[model samples]
Target: MLPDTLDITAIRADFPILSREVNGHPFVYLDSGATSQKPRQVLDAERAFVENFTSAVHRGAHTVAGEATELFEDARARIARFVGVGADEIVWTSNATEGINLIAYGMSNASLGRGGQAAERFRLGAGDEIVVTEAEHHANLVPWQELAARTGATLRVIGLEDDGRLRLDEAAAIIGPRTKVVAFAHVSNVLGTVNPVSSLVDLAHAAGALVVLDACQSAPHLALNLGALDVDFAVFSGHKMLGPTGVGVLYGRAELLNALPPFLTGGSMITTVTLTETEYLPAPARFEAGTQRVSQAIGLAAAVDYLDAVGLGAIEAHEEALGGRLLDGLGAIPGVRVLGPTHGAERVGLASFVVDGIHSHDVGQFLDDRGIAVRVGHHCAQPVHRRFGVTATTRISTYLYNTADEVDAAVQAVADSRAFFGVDR
Candidate 1:
């Protein structure tokens, strides 16, 4: 439950981009899963960094550089607190894709004997098994696939049930003695399904395998406490959380991060540089090599602050209402079939569906003409699409700024698309 005075109308006013028009109609942004629109706070924070305190961080002696470094570290601390992890465990990556690749590449380095004992724990070898699920986004799936190919390890996937939910019963049988790693999504970006993470984490731990969570969708929509989840590592994109692009957060257990070797190494991540011999810095800094996204990090911290002020729980409740409304409206349309669980009970605000006789691209283009923005494609989880027996789908995802009326508009536009294509009554 949430407070009655959530004031969603006021919340929608904060995003300036929402006021724009498309094709002679007001914009209806239902593609939040692709990327959320930035709030004024996040935008102003980035601008302020460039205008007032722009300097190279962690490698300069000047006043501006010191101030910049202080701001950067402070932002790190803020994000750490938001995710319920220690500041030292948070590493800034380019995006969730880079974060997942970091772990995959680190394990590959260890397997090649480039890293010491700390990294060896992560190393996958012949006969070792890496477990993932069919519902995983490619960011979570492809990295482990490449890692398996590199280390000669076998990759296993937990299949989805008939209703598009994870088949945990099958997972129990698959994650066995040889399993070294289990990576999956906390929430399905296309399906909007909330995974049973705690149970999955316990199962992976029982098999002595480390768990990595793709929290790209969940972190922005749900209340996340990584410490309580007991995951070894989790990754999420800043752009999807109302923050600026080119910045993401990787949360790893402090001990595990300290043990794993650096993924990208060069300038600024080293202790002392020499031609032949150089030692790396500690966990977070060592993982973040070269120049970092300083301003974007600061802006992300502001975005976190903004979300906190609005209250994550309230946002969740609001989005849940929107999800229910959207689901009901879409269900009323003939020839429309939602890909994931039809009920909104265990799902978020995102929903992907296919029309009986229209191509997804045609559906999307028709919606665009009516000023409704929706994602049209596989949404990067091709296996899930395959599970649903479709090559692609039209996804309508919502956020705090979305309204019940907008959901109605999107549903009407979808219905109009069907009629325009002569595929419906």
Candidate 2:
């Protein structure tokens, strides 16, 4: 469902990068799935924080330290509200990749008898299983594989159907008594498939397994409520959500987070330290070791505010409509094969496709030559492409800043690339 209307011109003006020209053509950025172009407001926020409140947080008692601490935690509170979680539930991470690793390593610690009885449920052993999907990004998949390697647990996978949807039947059979964790993507970065979270949640819960969501894609595009989803843990990157690159969010159910062991240990994450032994702090702080990403957090908060001001529903509507245009236009081009979700299916704001008789890099170069920025290659989800029987693809992704005209231009570029490479011949 889209809003009544959106002013594409006015929305595009907020982002300074849209005005950029490439190869003598006006820039048409279609790679938001890889990294979104930042708005001036977010950039200014980062600059303002560094220029003004450049002190370390949670350490000093001085005025500057207090100011920095307040701003940092305030950013957490703001970002927490945007995703419908409590501030304490959100732990700062270097990026979503790190966030997922935190959970996996924390659980590994539990398996090794680190967190005592509090983390017993997180432990996995010989016959135990950790389940993922064929549609997961490597961030969500690889860490679990490493965790399984560390703990002697078996790794199980839910297969994907022909249309790129997860096989719930396979999920029912694969996730059973031994399954200790079930992690999957809220939306496939490659497929644009909005997964049926509730059904998966029910299955995991019924099996007494913890559910971890890779929400790096969903957090920016959808109105997220981690608490409402009842997920045990979730991870999303700030950069993907219109924020800074060095910061990401790891959201855990408060109780679970408190019981979990810290992944990276250092300065501020401890409650008490001695030569003999050390006691760690609780949740957010427990996980946020060392000096925090103060300036980056503030910039992310500003991005959150900007997104809120634009209204997620409106953004969703805008992206959905543009996604429709992307799919329709790309589908119309000869030799272009959309990798996921067929025509008229519900999709988010991205598309990945392959053109017959042309390498994906050649297709990307042709598009790049026309000033359309797209993501080419495996997109960090090799399993998904392998599931679709392709090694790589050309991906066009959208955000609120994108327009239908740009989508058309990208489609035209794809068509032109096909002709230029003689793909249609």
Candidate 3:
């Protein structure tokens, strides 16, 4: 059973934004899938770093620089443990988009004979296949698309089933000898459908392909152990996990990262630079070029610490209960069609829906007027919306702080939206 201290009222108190009123109504933040509101601890961490020990890391020999470097690397180590990987395996990127691009660019370098043995492992050529799913966010999809274009490899995609789950039956036949890399999400950001990752990983490995998991949605809500999952690479953004923006984590097996060449080259990522030749730094340092987001990293480490204190398992259970409430309440509303699984069994707290005879933009605006925030549009997964026969959707995503009362408010707003727009039965 889940712990009783995960009470929503108490959890809500941790977030200051939840107390603020929007047009006299208490703010109901359901847009956590887009970006979560930070708790006081995370905010203070960032401020403390900027105020007390503001200095460039890994460069200066002075006291402040040494302190800053220690704090920065400590943050890296914390994030590494948070995702179940070695500290050296964690590459700090601007965001998950940059992280995915780093992998894609590394593969491109390998194809061009730039990377050594590591490059050979990732090299793609004619007849080699890279597999993705129709449900991928554009960050995951477009990078592979561009990689295929650059490497002269074929890009294949796993289609979704009628219920919006990734169709692994086709994947069995599609992932074959020519397949080089298999990339997909642990959970669909739009559909909220959790994929069978272990089974898919097995299939990909059996076919001699590497797996890259987009864990932007799952890492924030679920208990993720990348080492146990055994994927070659995994990427997630810090902002969605209650940390500041401009920071993200890319976890790769140490050997693979050590073998792959750096994506961005500059000051910090070099071992030695002669006038004529430059030798790069190893692993994480090689990937993290230029001035790192020092304070953001510190804040992200604090965010991980906060989540660990609350317990990810407890958070998941709380979200599942809220997901059940959301599914039931939204299902009963007229002119409302909830996408993905209508039940809570195979889902999390995120729900996407469409209203008959009313545009999603109108629905979003109506809900906002009632102090409810939801994501509306293609949600960066255009192909997924296309599969569901819609151009856009209104999505309500919950977090650890969300309550059953807020879920009810969201459902009521949806009903009110349809009625106000004259789409109600």
Q: What TM-scores do the predictions have?
A: 0.98, 0.98, 0.98
Clashes of 3: 0
Question: For residues 1-425, what per-residue lDDT tens digits would candidate 3 score against the true structure?
Answer: 32474866766778899999887789999999999999999999999999999999999999999999999999999999998989999999889999999999998888998877656888989899999999999999999999999989999999988788877789998999999999999999999988999989999999989999999999999999999999999999999999999999999998889888778888899889999978887898989889999999999999999899888999998888888888888889877788787673477889999999988999999989989999999999999999989999999999999877889998988988777877765
RMSD, every candidate, angstroms: 1.4, 1.3, 1.4
lDDT of 3: 0.91
lDDT of each: 0.91, 0.91, 0.91
Runs in model 1 deviating more than 4 A are: 1-5
lDDT tens per residue, model 2, 305-330: 99898888888988998888788888
| Per-residue lDDT of model 1, residues 203-272, tens digit only | 9999999999999999999999999999999999999999999999999998888778778989989899
lDDT-based ranking, best first? Answer: 1, 2, 3
Error of 2 at 43 (Å): 0.8
How much lDDT does candidate 2 score? 0.91
Candidate 2: residue 379 lDDT (0-100):
98
